[model samples]
Target chain A: MGVASTALPRGQTVPLALRWRRLGRRLGFLCGLAVLLSPALFVFLWMLSLSLKPDVENTAFPPVFIPTSPTLDNFREVFATSPFALYGRNSFVVATAATLLSLLVGVPAGYGIAKAKAHGLAFVVLVSRMTPGLSYLIPWFMLFRALGLHNTLWALIITHLVIGLPITIWVMMGFFEDLHPELEEAALVDGGGIWAAFRDVALPLARPGMVVAAILAFIFSWNNFVFAVVLAGPDTRTLPVAVFNVLTFEQLAWGKLAAAALVVTLPVLLLTVLVQRQIVAGMTTGGMKG
Target chain B: MGMTLTSAARHPGRPARRAVASYRRRDKYIRFALPALLVVAAVIVFPWLYTLYMSVQEWQVGSDRVFVGLDNYANLLRDARFHAAVGRTLVYTVLAVTLPVVLGTVAAVFFHRDFPWRGFFRGIFVLPMMATPVAIALVWTMMFHPQLGVLNYLLSLVGLPPSLWVYAPDTVIPALVLVETWQWTPLVMLIVLGGLAAMPTEPLESAVVDGASPWRVLRDITLPLTLPFIMVAVVLRAIDALKAFDTIFAITQGGPGTASETINIYLYLQAFSFFRIGHASAVVVVFFLLIVALAVGLLLVRQRTKWA
Candidate 1:
């Protein structure tokens, strides 16, 4: 209807054929979106159905798209037998630690890289990020083990840093580079020290960007599958690892598995919803550089 | 933030303390930047160097190592399984990249236009991208169950035949691709949506005003301008697809008889499962080179197109 309406702006004078064309165009556009989004949407709904269905219903042929007599057994099972609460606590601690550590170290580095125009350092950081996690797996595992850090939250926290720090640097790099230097210069002219100037002028302006970076980093650390699987201890399994343990220990219990999976995804999903705009910005801006 | 940057030297009183002040400032920059650099070095540098060293030695878990030169590389090249995996990896990456790019662009375009419940739909659209990948894998694993899965149930309603998806060797990569496409297409859409939002409106308006069909206006004006952003998406997806492991690991573990084993799976199997540490180091180095090469090539293309 967009171009069609442009061609025939006046509704009263528009020909019937033109009106039909506009309707057809609008229908076609809506259909494209429908076809594109249906699979993603359907899978989610199907997961919901799976989670709510009975164990017998979960395996029935012509699988129930919507549960007729949904039960809370799966949800009950998810919390009843497993150490889900412990896993959730562990994930929170590790993800928060990673985010705070990344911000502590990466923000200053980002500002330095921006001001110094340190392309080489930036390249080094980006390449570190680009390298597959597998490449770092064995060595980090052995090194931490050698240092008596294996199976400790410390080890997981350190490994998670590899994922979170680069993200902070990446998002903050964009923010710092775009920040006007004049603000910092004005503070310096007022006889402030460099740190004072940064704290007063630059840091406040970059707060929004820092929040975006932190949220992105937090989500990534929370969702990271490999690092936790390899580094975390028997007592310190993250949610992904704990959920995986459910899949294996509980066997194919699809209903319970669905419930477990949903539990694992809920926190991250809520965070994403809260900061959808920032997540999109962080991803696109960080993605563009790589 | 190791060795990030130095602070500026403070003005010395009567110019007598200039040297010490400047030195301290330089030291401060070194100090501020050092922590990040140290972490990178400890995490990436030390491990990578160890991997390179391990690649040349016949090392195993809890065993003495001996120098083996490039024999592991040579042996891997001669292995048919490795070659097949390389081929499969390329094929998977191609499908994974192409589908998301095209479908995502279309979805992006559709969302760009004024529509009913656009915000609500967009919120739904981005959910897939934000959900944990491990969770997505588990959910898809359930849905991919042949007789009991909801996907086939839906297909049965539409009169389409149900087929073995990840359970069959031949269809395993395709099934894996389906999961990947579902998970990643939203990301591509978000990127393209960002691009579309940023695009100038004048060219599109003028094209429609000049009596061009809507299709022509899209093809000639909209698509070309968004090509750069699309290319960026391509580059990101390509790298991601090349290294994809979690879903494959969780669902199939490169199974249905090695049908879906990408480089990552193979490396994991060699290193941790089989304990062929030396051989796995060789695989690591080779994979690292592949990533670097693709990244450089894509960056060059991006630069040539002025997408920077």
Candidate 2:
């Protein structure tokens, strides 16, 4: 297809048979892409349809793809019956706090590691990231109770650091590694101290990286289920836990459940759509380069 | 280089003094790393040490703790459920990793070619992975419904009988893995697409000029060049798959019986559900070892395949 398009001169016309064949091939390619994309598109669309339709239509025999009369009752019902507002607040607070804290700690660490060639320290951070969350959860659960911090957002915030901090460090490490060392060195060669060099030279250049790291950290922290499920009190439930609760308590209420799920996912979904390129870049760099 | 030139030109001598000053500066910078390291140590290192400590003692909820060194580990050996969970976890991980890697590579190859609306389609493709796992799981659970599900409806439309998806023990793991594959295959595709984008086109163009078959070119050149990226995808998918908890928990909660229960589910039950902290800690230790071993092994393989 690429060859056909690029090989042809702008003023030249293709033979009739070749043009027909090209059209056929283009259609085939579109079909293939659609087939590959169907599952992903269908799943989300189906959920959306479920959330829109009435209860009867939701569980209809053939399953309704579109509601005869689309309604917002399911979403309204969700807010009425559950403390989704509180859950949203909890998720926002925890995710924001965790991201900020991870940045404050991790960015400097990443810069230091890159500048000082502290491969051993970087490896430790990587290993810590790779360690299963459950391993830490058990100990943290015990420690939290011991320290009388269980069921508090403080407990949740600290635990989420394990997720956010590693990512911030890894992403920042990659960013710092890519930076020209001479910029900081030049700053140092001047009257600037190490702190000034970092604060003035490296930090400004790393702002985009910080944004990427912060977004990723926030997303992961927001999406975290296990830590919140174990550590959160009723009043402190995050969105995932709140959604899970809807599932448990309202098993057969498919519309309400779907609505709840969509509500919980809406923020991250919006973020994903808005900054997918950054997310993909961050994920690959953080995963592969680490 | 410029800094060094200017500094040397300014000083004319005392290069040794400059090196010492730079070394001192770097030493000071290393202190900036200490806060993060200390935080990680407090959060990760301390917990791991405590887990190890707890693993040696029998500490059930609402009871005095007693030292039972190695007993929990011994029990794990003799325990059939633990064995089954381990087996299930491994099988699940293999399916989860292999399917996504294969499908993703194929998808990446397709997406690498020119097509209309390619970027838009790729964006749509990655949605499942970025969506909250619990939400995706809930949606999949609805789709996996044997009677009312769209899946069964679609299957019936194709003249096939409706089958039990996540409800039946015999078919549960694969069914659950299907959801996993659906969600994660896009991730692998994205990673491999990156590799494809970064790859040199010279070999492929030359191979085409040599009249090499497309299949032959792909097998001998493209696959080999992308093997390192695929290995990276494998390593990541394996780690995440082994520790997969959210989707499985939200979907089947380890299933109709114990069929879908992987090591993670078992560990959750042991700790939170059963409240046997010691046993769960032992499981945690074993699980951590398993992950580290696999990671080290995969990293070794990845290193060997680092041709690019």
Candidate 3:
């Protein structure tokens, strides 16, 4: 199907059989891709529709795939009943702080690891990530309470860094490893110190990695729940925990839940799709595990 | 951004002055590393040490604790709930990882072609991953409703019976795996797609020239070349699935009689809900060990496979 210019003796007309076969293959390929992409896309579209519908239509039989009379009532309820704006603010602060913290610490760490070829040091970073959040849950919960930091954004930020910093370090290590040592070497020959070389040369070259790391770090922190649930007090509760809070009842408010979920996810989704190529790049570098 | 080159003896030119420069550079390296290491020590390492200590002692929140060495671990050995959660976590990880990888690889291979709107479609596919799991899970829980849900309505439109998803005890994990696959298959797809994009095309082109079928070309070339990426997908998905808390909590809360309770869920319940801090710490240590073992195994595979 990919062979657009197959060798077919210059003067010969195309064979009907081969054209039909190619057409069939193309159709089949399109069908396959559709089947693959449908579930996620359809579900997202469904959520969107659900979020827009009146509560009467939400649970109606012969369900509303699209809202006939679309309304903002659910979104209104989402904001009115809950302190969603406050939760959003908390999430923003926590995630941003986590990202900033990751950058502050992880960049230098990546530089050292790359320059020294310290695989073990990189592994140590990975180990922090590789351990499940639950492992950190109980102790952090207890210790933070002991230290009177339990309900504070500091605790949330610090715990969130456990998720973000490793990713930043991992992705940045790969970027630094891929750098040509000659750039730094040339800077050194120019009588510039190591700091000048790194700042003027290596760091500038690593801007893409920085963006990728920051975005990935922020996204992970934004989406995090366990740490927030275990450590965050009401004042510091982030969006995921807020969303989870709305589901505490056995009987769910699907409309409000859908609204809250959409509200919680919208920012990250837009940011991701807006900078998808970098997200793709970041994920692979961080995911493929340096 | 100051990089400290530590290997001074390996440098070119004068040895004497270079030694002083190298010493300064080493110091800078240590300084650069100090902040990150300190934070990790204070946050990750300290908590881990505390968890280890807590694991050995019989304790709970708001209670005077007794020092009961190895008792928590011993209790875990005899605990049926702990065993069930561990078993369920393994099953969940396996199912969650495998289905997504397989589906995602196929999607990736299909998308690697030069089709029109491929970028648009890929973006659509990647959207699910970008969305928060809490949102996805909440939406899915609604969709999984027995009645008054669009899914069952859609199934009825196709003349099929509506099925209980994440509701029935026997089918709970499979249903949760379905959501896992929906949300994460795109991530695996993106990873494999990256690998596929970077792959050399000569073998595939040659395969095509040899009158090979598309399946043959894929089997003989694309799949083999993408094995490392697939393994990456496996390792990542396995890791994420092993520790997943939000989606499971949102959708099922490890309910329908603990049928879908993974280790993370069980640990959360033990620690926070039950306030069995010592027992939960024991679970935590065991969970950490399992993660370490899994990670080491996957890293070995990556080593053996020689992925860049």
TM-score of each: 0.91, 0.94, 0.92
> How does residue A128 of candidate 2 score in lDDT?
79
lDDT of each candidate versus the true structure: 0.82, 0.87, 0.83
Which lDDT tens digits does candidate 1 get at residues B1-308? Answer: 11111222232133445445534554455455678998988877999999998898888887898899999899888978888888888899899999999989988887787767766677678888778888889988888888777777878889999978999998899999998998899889888887888889899877766768778877988888888889889988988898898889888989988988888999889888988888999999988888778878987988897865
lDDT of 3 at B47: 83
Residue lDDT tens for model 2, B62-171: 99999999999999999999999999999999999999999999988888887666666777888888888998888888888898898999999899999899999988
Q: What would the TM-score be for candidate 1 when compared with the true structure?
A: 0.91
**Model 3 chain A lowest lDDT segment of ten:** A2-11
Best by lDDT: 2
Model 2 scores a C-alpha lDDT of 0.87
DockQ score, prediction 3: 0.53
DockQ per model, Cα? 0.45, 0.55, 0.53
Query: True interface contacts reproduced by each model, as a fraction?
Result: 0.47, 0.59, 0.57
For residue A267, give model 3's deviation from the true position in Å. 1.0
- Summarize candidate 1's per-residue lDDT along A1-290 as a digit string, tens digits: 35335656445655887778778877877787778778877877777888999888888886767799988899898888888888889999999999999999998888777766677888988788768888798888788888999988888888889988899988888998898664665565456777876677778889988998899888888888988877788898999988877766776799999999998888887777677778878887887665
Model 2 over residues A175-283: C-alpha lDDT tens digits? 9999976566667667778888889789989998999999999988998999999999999999999999888888779999899989888788778878877887887
Model 3: CA > 4 A from native? A1-19, A250-252, B1-30, B298-308
